[model samples]
Target chain A: MPIIVNLDVMMARRKMSLTELSERVGITMANLSILKTGKAKAVRLETLEAICRVLNCQPGDILEFVEE
Target chain B: MNIKSKLAGIIINVSSFVIITGYGYTLYPSGIHNWMYSYKETDSLNLPVSQYEALNDSILTMRNLKNGYGFDHDNGQFAYLGTQTSIACDTCSYTWFKNNTQTYNQNYIKLNAWGIKKELPYKFYVKNKQGYVRKAVPVKNSDSKFNIVDVPVKFRYNTMDDAILIPVSADGASLFDTGWLILWGLNMIGLLFLLYLFIRFSYDTSKGRLFTRKNVTRLKLIAVSVTVYPLSIILLNLLVRFVFRQYFSPEVVLKDMVWYNAYIVLLIGIVLSLLYGAYNRAQLLQEEQDLTV
Candidate 1:
């Protein structure tokens, strides 16, 4: 339950909007929303690679473990 | 939360509906009078005289046709007509002939109001000034518990006198009734779509993660397919029944063959969906374990 998606934090640090990041990463706004809101049950490595490539970040930057 | 669990839930819900609806259709057919009668021998032979008289007339006709009719006291041959057969439901009734000498005083008659088959098992002896006259009972067995063991008389429904009984055999018609055929087709299409998703999910998950945009789209499509497919089947059944009533007579439309097919199709769909769900779940679990190692 505490598997957090830190895409929003990365986006904020990069000073980018969700729409801009989605377009750059070649993923849909809906999927980006899924990740940003932590609604996704799990993340595919390929998707993480695309996000990292576009945002100049690593998997660790976008995923974090926290206590519920 | 998992895709497999979600699919399993959908399968279970749809399977339950198919089973319940199948029983409902079997128990209640439109425009048929289904009745069962149980008679206890009384001292006065309290029977419906008019119905018995009608049955006697039919028996006389059958006897005349045979050209070898006799009132042998030894041979148990007789006729009776009556609406006294109390059907457990409001739909039908039965009547039969009984012998006073026989130790088995209890007689039963079953009438298939839709199919005009009557069975009367007991022979009744009527005492008249001339002597004893034997009578046979006219009743039909319409997939009910009772059977009229003698002549087959046509059943009448809603003032229609010429109503003929069409013997309904469970295996006479096509296995997939029209409604079931349609459901089966829909479920097949859904299964194909699910298979596509399953393949996509497998391919994506094999690459070590399911976060890809294509994988997400596939998952969404799978969820939507599972939710909509069964709901559409139920709605389509209602639509077909409505159309059937609007365009055809209820007597012709309410045959068991029509709905039996639908039930079978639904059952098959449920089974396939459950298998698909379980298979996908196992695959996902395996992928997760691989990732953990």
Candidate 2:
């Protein structure tokens, strides 16, 4: 419940549309939308690596912790 | 490729394959026979208490008629009036008369050889003023002279529509036939497996839960398969109809085609609804990730 996903901030900083980010990250637009909407239950290391490569960001920059 | 998602895929594929293969094998011998047989037990009531009583009474009356006329040991034939019509019983032969003529013959016999009286139940049909009637009469007292008084009987009007001429016994042995048991068992297992896979698919999270790219793609694949599989059946049926146009009427062909198509469409809608829930979950996950970033 406390897991964090920083997809929105990363998208804004990189100035990338969801479609563009999905293409760059090699994921589907539907999946990119999922990440943007905080619907993911967990994220894989490989997927995180892909996002970092596309947006030029660290994992910590994209993730945060919050108490539920 | 999380464990749960992988398991769900395996379950779906295995269940579909098993159902298709089982039905194909069972029906290949006689497709219509298998289909109609599946409906038979459900469509008609099984051997009810009333039917059993009717059978018992008929057998008892036949035996009484055999005894009353001092014909119990004679081995000669005797005929009497059944509740609905006239029934005749003999030591070796039995017939039922209706409309002033013998309308039924007992070529076959059902004997409870282990019973105290060692009696056999005989089945025959008679045509009366109303119509053809089917009755079961049991006969007893084989060692004594044949008498008309010992035959016990009850008549049952055959009300079954689309009667397949399948023999039914009051003993309930044929109800437990191996083929029927296997069919029902497989259907129950397949349904339970489907439910298990659905629950697992919903709760799985290793591939980032239902909303993740991999999981959603997997779900989409399954949904598409569910949709296309039934559609393929309809398409094949249509093609066959077209190829055999001279042999079949347009109305007959169209009716069957539309019925199956509608069924397929309903199945597709159900699958899509499940996928939509998974997609919505993915959206919520993405929004959470976006807010944190």
Candidate 3:
């Protein structure tokens, strides 16, 4: 629960809509929405790698750990 | 049907046939020769005793046979003292009856026996109810008016015999009329349907359809049917007793442990229904997670 996904910020920075990013990343838009809304329980390393490659950002840029 | 369902179906059909056939035999046992004459005569009476001075006092009580037998002329009463245990003798010709009520209660004494004999030293089985049983050997007291008996405790519940048939009564042919048989058949049919539902549920689970809404609803209906089964039987029995108050009593109906066991089954059904509800919610959560990226 402490780990947050910052996929929306990265997507905005790259000027990419969720659908376009989903197409580029070969992942469903619904799943990308889940990642953006921080509802995903965990992200597989393979899925993380794909998202990072498509968005042109490091894993840390998309994922953040905020201490409670 | 798939293999799993096919196997389940075969077992279900075979078992259902067996059970229904067995029920039919019990329902119509008239073909058996002289089976209706198997009733034994038992006389039950409550006698009030006025004197009890010590622990070994020979309590004297008397009852009339005409009042005890009532209208049950067939006289089919019997008691298996200690069914599975050697503690009580099955063939001990000694004429004595065990106290049905605990001796600690001092006012009235209750007992059931075949016949009563008048004598100086009466043989009686003394029991402190629940667990304690002893044989009271009576002897003439010093005053010669009252008898004194020495009772040595024989067995406790822990050491009691395991395989004894307590009291078995055969409801004579006259007792099982057409109406009673019809009611019993209806109850049996309900049970058969319950078994069918159980088989279907098991077949579905074997097919990996455990968390489907169909299964959830099925389980709920099963729960309700089982819960209602015992309740409906008890209600019917109560109604019969009410209508035939002259012939029936609560003691007669409540003696069967099957009624209480049905309630236990009802409780189990209710618990399963609750678990099914929890599983349904978890199933929905899993479905949502499956669709998520």
Candidate No. with top TM-score: 3
**lDDT of candidates 1 onward, in order:** 0.42, 0.43, 0.45
Angstrom error at residue B235, model 2: 41
Please give, as one word, the docking class of candidate 3: incorrect
Q: Taking the tens digit of each residue's C-alpha lDDT, what string does model 1 give over A1-68?
A: 68887888888999999999888888788777877886676677787888899889888888888997
DockQ leader: 3
Stretches of model 1 off by over 4 angstroms after superposition: B1-58, B61-293
Off by over 4 Å in 3: A1-24, A28-68, B1-189, B249-253
What TM-scores do the predictions have? 0.29, 0.26, 0.36
Which digits, one per residue and each the tens of the lDDT, describe model 1 over residues B183-289? Answer: 55666786888898879788878986655545656665665566555455446544543532332232222334324544666666666566556655766675454
**Tens-digit lDDT string for candidate 3 (B199-218):** 88899989987776677677
Q: Could you tell me which 10 consecutive residues in candidate 1 chain B have the lowest summed lDDT?
A: B72-81
CA lDDT for candidate 1: 0.42
Q: Please give the ranking of all candidate structures by lDDT, highest first, separated by commas.
A: 3, 2, 1
Work out candidate 2's RMSD over C-alphas.
25.9
lDDT by residue for model 2 (B1-293), tens: 69965654454343333432344335323321121121122213344565444433433343332322111211111011011112234331112311234322211111111011112122222212111212223346555543221221222211111111111232332332333356456646754765565666666764455455545555655566556645654564455445434433211213333455658675885768586676868766775675332
* Deviation from native of the Cα of residue B78 in model 1, angstroms: 29
